[model samples]
Target chain A: MDNKVHLITEQDIHAYIDGELSGERKAAVEVFLAERDLPLERAARYLRNNFDLKAVRDEVYRDEKLKSEIDRLLARRKPRRHLIGASA
Target chain B: MTNQANTISTEDLNACLPALYRFAYTLTRNDDRASDLVQDCVERCLRKQHLFDGQNLRSWMFTVCRRVFLNQIRRDKVRGVAVDMEDAPQSKLSISAFQEEKMHYQDVVESFRELPHNDKVVLSLVAIEGLKYEEAAELLEVPVGTVRSRLSRARSRLRDLLENSGEEGTVVAASV
Candidate 1:
C-alpha cells in the first residue's frame, strides 16, 4: 500500500458507478477502491439493471398495434391554420 | 405538416416512439393509459414544436410526457377521480411473453414494474431514459439530491429482486 488515506463516501461510490464522476475524482476513487481490492461490482450491477430495463422497454414497444396507432397520429394533418384561413 | 422547418416531423416522432411509450407506460402502468398518454404527448409536441429548441428531442419529449401525465391526473382530480392512487385493477401488470423472447425477460420486467411508483419513476428516468441526475430532477421537478436518494433506493431494491429471482449477478455483470 502507498499508505495514502482517501475519503470515499456513499455518494461518491454511487456517483462513480453512475458515471457522473469527473476525471480527477474518478482516478482518486479508482485508487481508493484499488487499495481495498474492490471489483467495481456496483457499476456492473447498475449497468446490468440498465440493460435489463432496456430489454423490458423494447418488449413494451413491440406492440405493433400500438405502434401503428402512434404512427397514424403522427401522420395526421396539422391543425387548421388560425382564424386567418377559415373557409366555411 | 406546416411550412416551418422547425416543426417536429413524422420521422422524428417515429424515432422517439419507443422511448416515449416506455416512459408513458412507466407513468400510467397500464397499456391503454400509457398509449393515450403517448398519443397526447405527441400531439402536444406537434402543436408546440415551435417552442422546442431542437437541441435534444428526447429530453423535450420526456418533459412533455411528464407534463401530459400530470395534467391528466389533475384533470382526473377535477372530475372527482382519485389521482393519488395507481389504478388497482391493473396493479397485477401482467408481463406475459407476447413476443418471441423467453419467459426470463418477462420475469425481469415484472420484477422491475413491481417496485414502488417513485422507485420505478427514478429508475426509469435515470436508467432507462439515460438522463443525468440534474436532467431527471428537471423532469421530476425535484432536487438533484432527491433523485440521488431515489436512485440509490431503487437500485438496491432491484438488486434484491434480481438476487431473489436468481437473475445471476455475475452473469449479468459479464453480459453488461
Candidate 2:
C-alpha cells in the first residue's frame, strides 16, 4: 500500500481532487487511480471531510444567541436622521 | 415602503450581518471573538458610508471586515498578545460514538489552523466562503498563481498529515 501512492504525482492528485487539471492530465489521473490499491474511497473521504467548511459556517449560523447580538447591533446603527429645517 | 437611497437601513444590515458573522467566525475560529469582530467591522462601515459604492456590497463588506480583523491582530501584536494555536479548547462531544471520525475532523481543523495566517485566510475564502479562485486571489490581494501555490501546498500537506499519522495526536501545532 505504501507504494500505491506512486501511481499519481502529488500535484496531479491535487489537481485531480480540485478539478483543476483537464484533458490529458485529467485522464492521466483517472487512469492512475484505476490501477492503484490505495483505497481511493478512503482518500476521497479524507478530502471531502477535511474540505467541507460549509459545515463550520453552518455551525456559526446555528448560534441563535450570536444572531440576536448581531441583530441588536444592527438595530442600534439605524442611520442618523436628516436635518429638515436648516437650509442656509 | 422603504427608500433605499436615503440612508443605511436595518434591513440591509440584517441581511449583511450573517455573512459578516460567518466570515468573521472563519477568520477568528472563535465564536465570541468573531462576533465582536463583525460588530466592530459593521460599525466602522456604517460610519464610513460614503466609501461604499453599492456596486458590490458583499465584497465591500468583506474587505471592510477583513481589514478590521487584521487591524485587531496588528494592534494585539503591539500589546504583545500571543495567539496560541494549541490553546483552542477541544470539542466537548463524547468520543464514544464515531471516535475516529471525530478525531479526523479535529485533526483537519487543527492542521488548517496551523497554516500560516495568510494561507488560512485564502483557504477559508475559497473552501469555506465558496469564492472562486479569482475572487479569492483578489480578496487576498495576490496573484492567481500565488493563490494556486498556497492552496496546493495547503491541501497536499493536509493530505500527507492525515495519511501518515496517529488518529488522536494533534498536528495543528506542527502544521502551523
Candidate 3:
C-alpha cells in the first residue's frame, strides 16, 4: 500500500459522488475516501439529500388535474390523420 | 394543413405531458403559469409541426419550453414585474405532522424555492429531470462545463441552506 496521503478537495468529492471523475483520478478518490470517515459520510449525506429533493420534485408531475387539463387542450386540436382524411 | 406532415401524434404528445408539465412547473414555480406554458408550447408545436422531427420529440419539446420560459422572463423584466413571495402560488405540498423526514423534505423544498431562477433551472433539468449534463447544456444553450459549474454551485448552496435552516428550527406547525 502506498503510504502517501491523497488530498481530496470538496469539488473532487462532489465530482466523485456525481460520477464525473474517471480512470486514475477516480481510483485515487476512492482510495482517499476509503481512508476518511467524515468526508465519506458527508458525501453520502449529500447524495441522500439530492435523492430526497428529486423525489419530492417528482410529485409535481403526478398531478392528475394538470394531466386532465392538458389532455383536454390537446383533444381540441384536430388530428393530422383526420385532417388528411378530410382533405382526401 | 401545411404543417401536417411533421406533426406529433396526439398519443405521442400526451405521453410526454407529465414530463413537460414537470419541467414547466420547476421553471415557473407557479401552477397557473406552468399550465399556461405547457398549453402554449403544445399550441406552438401543432402550428410549427413541420419543424419537429419524429424522433427526439422530448428534447425538442424541452428546448421549446425553455425558450418560451426565457422569453417570458425577458418580457417580465422589460415590464418590471418582480417575482416575489406574494407572486408565489400556494404551497403545493402540505406539511402535516412533524415527522423528521417530512420536515427535512419540506426544508429542502423551501431552500430549493429560494435558489436563483437560473440555478433552479439547471438543478431541475439535471437533477430532478435526470437529464445528462450534455443534454442539459444543450437545452440551456451553455457549454457542458458551465452546466457542471452551475450544478456544483447550486448543490453547495442548497447544502448550506439545509444546514442553516436545520439549526434555525424554523419548522412550521402542521396545517392539520
Candidate 4:
C-alpha cells in the first residue's frame, strides 16, 4: 500500500458510496474515509438523501387514483373492433 | 396495425406505470403535467405496440415518456408557455404537521426540486430508481460517461443545497 495520502475526489467518494468502486480503488476509498470526517458525513448525507427521495417516489408510485387514471386512459385507446357486416 | 408486430401486454404496461409516472414527475415537477405526459406516453405505447421489440418494457416506456416530455418542451417553447418548476407544492401536506423525520425527508425533496432538470432526471434514474449508469445511459440515449458525470455533478450540487439549507450540521450530528 502506498503510504502517501490520496486526495479523494467527489466522484470517487460518490462512487465509493454507490458501490461502483472496486478492488484496490474501493480499499483506497475506505482508507480515505476512515481518516476523514467531512467526506464521510457527506457520503452519509448522500445515502440519506437517496433513501428519502426513493420514499417520496414510492408514495407517488402507490397513488391508486393515478394508477386507475392511467388504466382508464389506456383502456380508452384500445383498437375499435367492428362487426363483419356493419355499415360504415 | 400489422399482424406480425410485437405487442406488450396491458399488465406489463400497467406494472411499469408508477416508474413512468415518477420519471415524468421528476421531469415536469407538476402533478397535472406529469399525468398528461404519462397518459400521452401510454397512448403512444398502445398505438405503437406493434413496433415494440419486447426486450425491456420498462426502458421502452421510459424512453417514450422522455421523448414525449422533450417534445412538449419544444412545443411549449415555441408557444411561449414556460413550465414553472416552483408552482406546485412538493408534497400534499403542510410541512409543519409532520414529525422531525418526515420534515427532514420533505426538506430533501424540496432541495431536490431546486436542482436543474437534467440533474433531477439523472439523479432520479441512478439514485431514486436504482438504475445502473449503463442502463440509465441507454434509457436517456446518452453515453455512460454522461450519466456518470451528470450524477456526480448532481450529487455535489445536492450536497451544497442541503448544506446551505442549514440542515447539514444537524444531519451530521444526528447521524453521529
lDDT of 3 by residue, B41-146 (tens): 8888878878875545665676577567657666654543332333322322222322333556677777777776667666666566555565567666689888
User: Which pairs clash in model 1?
Assistant: none
Model 2: residues >4 Å from true position, as ranges?
A1-9, A37-46, A49-52, A58-88, B1-99, B160-165, B168-176
* Candidate 2's TM-score: 0.39
Candidate 2 lDDT over A1-88, as tens digits, reads 1224334665555555554556555555654643342533333433453344434444433445533543443344323245233212
DockQ of each: 0.09, 0.06, 0.08, 0.09
lDDT of 1 by residue, B113-155 (tens): 6677678766766665556676667666789999888888888
Which CAPRI tier for candidate 1?
Answer: incorrect
lDDT of 1 by residue, A47-88 (tens): 445655754665533545533543443344244346233312
What are the root-mean-square deviations of the candidates from the true structure over C-alphas? 18.7, 20.4, 19.6, 19.7
DockQ of 3: 0.08
| lDDT leader | 4
Error of 4 at B16 (Å): 45
First chain TM-score, candidate 4: 0.57
Q: Which 10 consecutive positions of candidate 1 chain B have the poorest summed lDDT?
A: B92-101
Error of 4 at B56 (Å): 43
lDDT of 4 by residue, B1-176 (tens): 33433887788888878766666655554455667889999999999887776555665666566568658766654543432223214432122222334556566777777787678777776776665565567667789888778988998898788778875345323322
lDDT of 2: 0.53
Clashes counted in candidate 4 amount to 0
Question: Fraction of true contacts reproduced, model 1?
Answer: 0.19
Residue A72 alpha-carbon offset, candidate 2, angstroms: 22
Candidate closer to the true structure by TM-score (higher is better), 1 or 2: 1
